[model samples]
Target: MNEELSARLRTAAEAHQPDRARILARLERGMSGAPDRHRESSGARPWPRVALASLAAAGILAGGGFAVAAIVQSPPARPDNSGTPAAPSAPSAPWTPPHTTPPAPTTGGPSAPDRSSSTSPSPEVSGGTVSARPDSAHVQDGPLWSAGSLDASSNTYWAQSDITLKTTQPLTALTVELRITQTGAVQSTGHWRTLPADDFTVTVQPEGAAVVYRWTLKPGRTVPAGQHVFAGQYNHAAGRREAKHDGYRVDATGPRGALSVWGGFTPAR
Candidate 1:
């Protein structure tokens, strides 16, 4: 009996064929709590129902477990990123500072251009000799100088002052003024200079307590280097009029700067 049962089991297993429609029908009836109509129609025994259920379960596992899961379950949740070891991040590149251009080199100061070799030259006196006047009252200042002499030809009724100026350099501008202290009815007679008459503007006027005679070189005109003379003639009351208090002022301009000289006059005894 055991051998025969084993043989029968072998034959049943061999004859078993997986039918999706039949298995699903059975599954549907079981889910709906309805009797298995096919089993009742065939008058199959209860064990046959058990066998069908078991075979159905086996068919599901063997044939269509993945297919059933694909139909029944929702799409798998997005893969969990937390547990997975993150792909090794590509090695970070070395940091490098931005390239910078340095500021241009600078100099301490701008090189000054070379000016004239010298500002003031050794005092140059062109025709350079100075006149000898033993009897004259003379005063000198650097390159610009002046001298005064009382004219011997003056009579008791008149007196004269002769002024001489010497300059080493050609004078671009010159002004000579003589002030004779008024004594005994002093009055102007005339005035003269060695420079061209047109080169000077002469004026005789009374200033303060003295008679002033001025010679101004005209604009655009120049006095050549050497000695130049200017004279003032005036009449005074009968007696000898002392000229010790007489004075002179000279203002001259040269290439670099101005020259000025002024002093009182001493007539010969």
Candidate 2:
């Protein structure tokens, strides 16, 4: 029984050893092929890594191009002493002042005459008479006139005459003379000479107005002789009359008498 058991054990051991050898062979083949697969996987891994890196580099370059385009499109910066950019300045307007107006001018009227150089009044004469010789004659033997007595009539008589003197000299003196006579009744109580009343007036008609020289004569009055005997008598009537052309007039009033008048001028030197 023991021998039979040993034979059976030996046969079983032989069978198991063959099966185990086949399994070991299969494992060895699998192990040898593992290194080749690992090499292939490692090579494929490096290609994926290189492709990812290239994609990342292209994205970075595209971003840099966009940044440069933005910088080129923007405006240039103004320089300042500080590091900051300056703001733009606004435009200014013109300046002006307020306005004003001026005033207007005034006007006036005409003026008056000056009274400081007016002439004075004439002086009175004494009863005496004077004689004068003229250097030149103005009038001689003018017509005579008469006035009746105051009892017969009260009418006054006047005569006027014009004469021109020819001389190239200045005259300083003027004289007038008259011839007088009396007529009509004479008595012891009232003689014709005693009863007659007479008045004589001589006038110089210069350029402007008549200037009068007067004498009141008695029946037989005497006259003194001189130059410029009637010099200061002017405007004795205190009135103005029209002047003749370089001439004069005689005016007489009496009760009963006849009178004749003559006049001339004297040279200055």
Candidate topping lDDT: 1
lDDT (Cα, tens digit) per residue for candidate 1, span 1-269 = 36663454444345555455665666657844767654455544467666677787676645454444343454756557689755566999999999999987787778666665433222212133121222233366567888777887888899888888998888999888787787769899999998899999998888667778988999999999899989999999898778777867677898767886665555644
Q: lDDT per prediction?
A: 0.71, 0.31
Query: Least lDDT summed over 10 consecutive residues: which range in candidate 1?
Result: 124-133
Model 2, span 121-174: residue lDDT tens? 222122343321122222322233212111212112222221222212222222
Maximum-TM-score candidate: 1
TM-score of each: 0.48, 0.18
Per-residue error for 110 in candidate 2, Å, reads 17
- Itemize residue pairs with steric clashes in candidate 2: 129-224, 130-224, 131-224, 131-225, 148-255, 149-255
